[model samples]
Target: MMHRQRGVGLVEVLVAVLLLSVAVLGFSALQIRAVSATDESLVRTKSMTLVRNLSEVMRAYPEAYVTVSGTTFVTAAASDAGAVPTIQAVISGSATNTVKVDSDDISITGTDSCLSTGIKTVDDKKVAKQACSINQLAARDALMVKKIATDEDIKVNVTTCPGTTTQAIQTQMCVITAWNSTKAILDDDDEKACADSNGIYKSGSQCLISEAY
Candidate 1:
């Protein structure tokens, strides 16, 4: 009778082990889903910030955006055109642009573009905040975005169609901004509204759309 009781105890232990294994597997799956959701949220937030930042930059400096047809400024680090650190966007008049992401320089912008104009002041006040170069503002904005985005691909697109901006000088610029975070999980049709059929990247990355002139 003692031997029979020992065998029954062993069977009970085996059943408990099997149940524990199943519970662990279920917990692991839930953990994975939570992590993936967090990643998606982070990617979307960062990407949207970049888009809004760029639009504000352009709206603040209308002159620079028009002249950005061939200006290739460094978008990362404290580097200029020739002093570029590694690689960055080559700003142009094209509709689409690609920029590398970095999260190491948050306070890289906010420099007064009109910081050197003591040429002639009012009664005695120094006219330092006169007018900053358009290119300078654009560069500052791009750098801020680079710092916000870490190891992500940011795509910017400007659409000036079906709109009109009557300018005293230069062509009309009814500009619109559309940006995409390629690293995020998005539907294929999300970016469709921003580009033509040929411009699509075919990657299902949700696009946060905004418009500014």
Candidate 2:
């Protein structure tokens, strides 16, 4: 009697190939997703590191170096040669003796002078003899000083005198006035956002079980 050849049918072979294709496709998708997640995480970590480095540079500088112009401290790169960097201080207000009316409805006036008056007598006899002379000299020196308006509303007055002796004086003044009827400009939002989206991982075939025979 001739025995019938036993072998997998063409249909069975095709089914097996289809199943294998499906499994391979699923694994490929999983691999692609995992790679994307890892890339996103790396980008976020880099951004965080950059921000941290900037913060460290800022911390090394003194608080006096910070200036508030319109509710923000303008920052620049540090120039220090040491491990801790340094930032230069910027003058926020108007020039040395200038006045400015800011958008915040505030008016500021500054005054500067190079010469002031003080008495230095050479001796008791000179003091007694120059008491009256010094008074007249002080008045004359005051009249000789030049006054210049540095700004539209700011003024600078300078005085100088060269006698048989030498004396030095300096003065600076700044005044800020808020416009009572207007509101000052305010900065409410001063923060950075996350650099990128968070990464995610989904369950794959490894999480499932095989059928039992």
Candidate 3:
């Protein structure tokens, strides 16, 4: 009888340890999820702020920032031409207006006349600072985007909201933003939520889509 009691006590100890181990594992998983959620929240906030900044800048300089050329929207980079960060926007309406932003746009070399110290020598050898041209101001804003986007692969797209008719696409612009994250947040089947045939955001994408009128 004594031996049987001892065996039962030992079994109880083992079972208790097993239960504790399971509990610890569950707690660890919860902690990981919490951290992931927090990080994603931060990313979303940053992305929204960045996209809004760009949208506001575009609005401020509508004529220079983007011009509707036939069926496409286009702009040029005149400041910090070497910077490589680019943003693409599409105006979807009667025609798909594609905007391709890259270094191929106009690059202003030599002293930037937009600066206070920039002086251009005219034909009469007179030197004076000139106000920033509309294109130059737009380029400066683009350069700002390039600088802010450093260290992260950021992509922006302007599209019609899902399920919205093409006719209304011109009035509403959906600014979709995505950047790099530690791990993939997109499910294998849900790639279309953040990306499409136009382009793909970086792997481990944290994406946010904001609509602007």
Candidate 3 yields a Cα-based lDDT of: 0.50
Candidate 2 lDDT, 90-184, residue by residue in tens: 12222332211111111122122222243456754333322322222222222221111122221111111112121112111111111112111
TM-score of each: 0.51, 0.29, 0.58
Best by TM-score: 3
The Cα error of candidate 1 at residue 90, in Å, is 6.0
lDDT of 3 at 84: 15
Name the lDDT value of residue 108 in candidate 3.
Answer: 29
> Roughly what TM-score does model 2 have, to 2 decimal places?
0.29
Clashing pairs in 2: none
Q: Which is the winner by lDDT between candidate 1 and candidate 3?
A: 3
In model 2, where do residues sit more than 4 Å from their true spots? 1-8, 64-213
lDDT of candidate 1?
Answer: 0.43
